[model samples]
Target: MYECYLTFRSITPCQQAQRYLTGQSLRSQLLRTPKSIAFKGCGYSLKLNDTAIGLAAAKLRQANISYGSAYRIYSDGRVEELYL
Candidate 1:
């Protein structure tokens, strides 16, 4: 399964990440699609549609947000970074 992990460059006081997220948080807009052979992250990973990754990245950038990277795992069990 292909997984997208998003980690902040410098996450401070880990607890801050929790306080920042509350009722109806901004992350609520993020959605995951299982039909695309993707897996949702445990905590911070934002599961997005592979085809829409670019659009999502753009929106994130416009919102002053950043993501770690994108991973593509092939049927042969080879995983690599892919462009959006």
Candidate 2:
């Protein structure tokens, strides 16, 4: 299955997003942002299944949590940047 990495500007928002997503019953993993995809500088990210991207995005929006860019990691190792 593909995975989606949702990047955040800072660790604060990243942690808030993880907590909010957990409250909404969505599964996410908090991890250091991959060097290749980290925004601006070092950061963190929420890793979840690609299937949950839409609902997760909606939930985050409803909670007023802002995030940076998102990237979809393909099974074959290709990474595509998402504009959402």
Find the candidate with the highest lDDT and give its number.
Answer: 2
Each candidate's number of clashing pairs is 0, 0
Q: lDDT per residue, candidate 1, 1-84, as tens digits?
A: 564433333334122332333221434123232223334332244444455455655555555555555555555666666565
Candidate 2 lDDT by residue in tens digits, 38-80: 6489899999887787788888988889988889877777788
Q: Which residue pairs in candidate 1 collide?
A: none
Error of 1 at 43 (Å): 7.1
Candidate 1: global Cα-lDDT?
0.43
Worst 10 residues of 1 by lDDT: 28-37
Off by over 4 Å in 1: 1-43
RMSD score of candidate 1 (Å): 7.8
How much is 52 displaced in model 2, in angstroms? Answer: 0.9
Q: Residue 22 of candidate 2: its Cα lDDT?
A: 93
